[model samples]
Target: MILPAPIPDRVDVVIFGGGVAGLWTRWRLEHAGYSTLLLESSSLGHGQTIASQGILHRGTKYAFGKDVSQASMELLMAQEVWSRAIKGVDGPDLRRVTVLSPTTVMWTSESFLSRFTGAVAAGVLKSDVKKLEGDARPAAFKSAPKAVNVWEIDEKVVDSSTLVRELARVVRGPMASLAPDAHTHWDLPGMLSWTDAAGRSHATHASAAVLCAGVGNESLITSLAGTTSVPGAAASHVSQRRPLHMVMMRGAPCDLFGHCIRELSDKPRLTVTSARDADSFVWYLGGSLAEDGVSRDESTQIDAAKLAVHECLPWVDVSRASWATLRVDRAEGRTATGKRPDTPIVSHIAAAGHTLAVWPTKLALAPAAAGRVFDLLETAGIRPTGVIDAGEPALSPAPLPWNEGGVRWR
Candidate 1:
């Protein structure tokens, strides 16, 4: 319902950032018949997305042997979207990943298993479930394991770099070109003010601007007028949850394809997860103030990755460090008891005439966020959801994850 703006040369919907969310947004918008223009300050996907261990969550996050909830339902749908997008645009070299290499997921405590199992028995797990089994050991964890009822599934791993490259090819399309006009720096560096090497800026005539800048959205705190509000995150919790992540060039022996595991921390409610890719293992520490920024030393974290994985591979080459990026996972609308909050979307920058901010990786939760943003644009009479939100988090904009350091699309 966006009222037609003053005559502009192009109504290109400018998305900032070139990460998964930005690329996904471009795909969604273009497919929906919108003339979209994407701008990446660096290249594409030199940031957090490439550092991923490639465990495309198919709603199996906390649902090891349990049922899929509303969140899981949306996540499954997102996975399908990811699956289709990857299959459609990905090249053979890019898609050449260790497909279906098995792994195990375990919970140390039986009590937690009881709750998880109880949820499954009660049909909570079957709602959006593709499959659910318990008390069975996959050969991977069966060789010698201390846990029970390890569940495994047929999921996919993304060579994120390849995925990004294919996505870039698809979205850039034959006609898409470097936006050759000097972009207006709308009080920001990358997204709002993107002007590719050709110098073209974003179209200001759009009904609303979508901020896919990731944690860098802080750059828009000025646009939002003041600081953003964090409901349940605090300094102590964030520090306690501060994680150290590393990637070992040492070549792990484990078959990590389509496998992800989380080890709950000794500290109550804290956890760090790991997923092994063909190249290395990706370590993620959570249950702290992921939103307020990490309290741990970034370099030390990398060292820890070396040491932990070094135990598994003594000859690992510590010299060639693969790509790494620092990020604080933000959550929204925490429960009163304060566990990891489910699916988040913050609407309106209070006074900004027409802008929306989001954590793009939370694609499972983005359908809701996008609906809200589009609703706002609808108030201004602009309609852009022609492709519709198929429960995917493809909102709007390109990310900074891709860079020249590695052709993320490669």
Candidate 2:
């Protein structure tokens, strides 16, 4: 469709969006030894990548209950995401080393645990499933057997932004160039910069392009060539169920000897996570506070969030707690029956013929997702993994069960 011709056509790839999906795509593509150029409408990590709750998501959390359909769609696959991040790339500067510590996550009911077991049988859940009869450990969740059942698993909190920066550095090389604090315009098989606060503009080109923009997929579709139309409504699903996680840090240990995964206050729609970050203990609270695009007022939202976070963990004095609010929009198509479209929706603009359109779970799938796109390019076809949804379903497929007296993690 009107790709820039100034740069040589030999360029292998052009990537849009500079967050986890985009940057990770850049890193993996460069390592695969293809000449690549990355462009973004705004600065990198301006999207959800930075807003992530910071869990390498073990996929174990998906073991909610018996609904295999929901569990399969929700399968953490994060294990793979984390695994690849640490594999193949090894250097002191690279985040090759990851720390996994013992943490306990509990579901208060056996009925819920049974649903989880059914999910495992359906391949939706991925973890060691056990049902217990008595109190669990971690000192935090330990209680009478009927009170709770905990699954002690390995979890790690890697530096998400640092991960992206490292990937960018690796892509650019030791003496390579970077255009941080820059804006880009995609003009099919290329990039054009008209102007910025810095003034003046420049142009560059590439062979193929990947649109890694998450919620901003709409703008990319309108501007870039080969991008198919992804209606604005679908993209905003994430913003519709916006949850604000306020992580209040105070009196957290000097060292993060391990991580904590307590069951924060309940929100049927979202997950609120509290754990020890770096040098401070954090009380993270979030859920479906905002529904269908009508989010809470910031001042009021902050107050409500503080109270919720403090309820579960009293150590965090909301008044004295230092805080940061992380917001993320859910993008799944829906969650009623837990059925997403069997395939992800990808569009190619025949006019520009260089850009591509993608949405939904595409963010969670990142690098491997990119690799699949590259393969499709070589074969002149598309292979979609799954569609998007807004937030977790009310009754997600139950994963394997874990509690007192049913079984153990031996």
Candidate 3:
């Protein structure tokens, strides 16, 4: 818990949420001379951001398709943006952020479609994939079957905890955590009134409002819809939640960051990223396994994970490894067909008095999402008129998902 800070009664913009998208937007706007105040009802990165695998995708994942997808293009641009920022060469300096892996591997099982995908991905991706053979392969893949092909894709992975910390460090305004009931009455045009945990009512008047609340965006959008005079404006601003039952294995045999590609599958069979968990290491599983595991119970998900590891990486031993499951929702902007969105979405509700709703469909797209916000603000003629002095941040970065407690490993 953070000590209370003096809340400013007014700002240029009032941002709702503390996830990566929210933090990034605050950083960008504040640096661009806009006065902003970020309000969070929970700890920073409490939802989708912290739960992410932290992969800065360089378009390799989308290369299996017939042509370059919108997601591929967005992520490709995002990788360069993130690389510059992390190297302190351009954008917001993030030199202190830790890059967990310089490149993640992609291995394919011996099959017609798998081999075809391997060839197509190598051709389509802007970033080159270096095929690792013989001794060049990591220990985890050394004993893999001869038919399995492993290529190192130039995708960077960062430590989510450090990323959040660095972003929060750069923001110029106060990031206060609001109470559960702090989804206060908005004074429509500019007023934002909410009560803190101390029962003190605070109000702020902003030139614009930004919603980056992830799943929490649903209610906020509904409220915005109620205020707007434009019919069907709410339809474009709605949120969707795609569930994922991710499997985690503690005491992983070896450090590995890669995706397992199978026959006729565009998505990875299992996307694993190793992270330091207390005194041990954890293999966090995602990809098709996670998407399909949504309907599975905890015990069944673990069983599926075990079987996946055995089939995907036969060399690795997880016989004694403890397993757990984390259920999370991938919050995104609602699409017409309810399918996954290919790019970051940024919508402006002009009728709702300078309100904008944003969803960075993937972690890699957060920068692009912020860029869109800038575009919207520019189009609306909103300028940085003054500065807001709200003191220091009033909330701390949330714990890593593995360390958040309540998981029962077996």
lDDT scores for all predictions? 0.41, 0.43, 0.82
For model 2, state the Cα shift of residue 82 in Å: 2.4
Best by TM-score: 3
Q: Estimate each model's TM-score.
A: 0.58, 0.63, 0.94
55-117 in candidate 3: lDDT tens per residue?
998878777754447777889889999999999898778899889899999987667678777
RMSD of each: 9.5, 11.8, 2.1
What range of 10 consecutive residues in model 2 has the weakest lDDT sum?
Answer: 394-403
Pick the winner on lDDT between candidates 1 and 2. 2
* Regions more than 4 Å wrong, model 1: 1-8, 63-70, 83-149, 173-204, 223-249, 257-341, 344-346, 361-379, 383-410
Worst 10 residues of 1 by lDDT: 233-242
lDDT of 1 by residue, 63-178 (tens): 54323365566667666555544454522122333333322232222245443553443243344333324335432333333332333444454455655665555543222222
Clash number for model 2? 39
Q: Which stretches of candidate 3 lie over 4 Å from their true place?
A: 110-113, 226-230, 233-237, 389-392
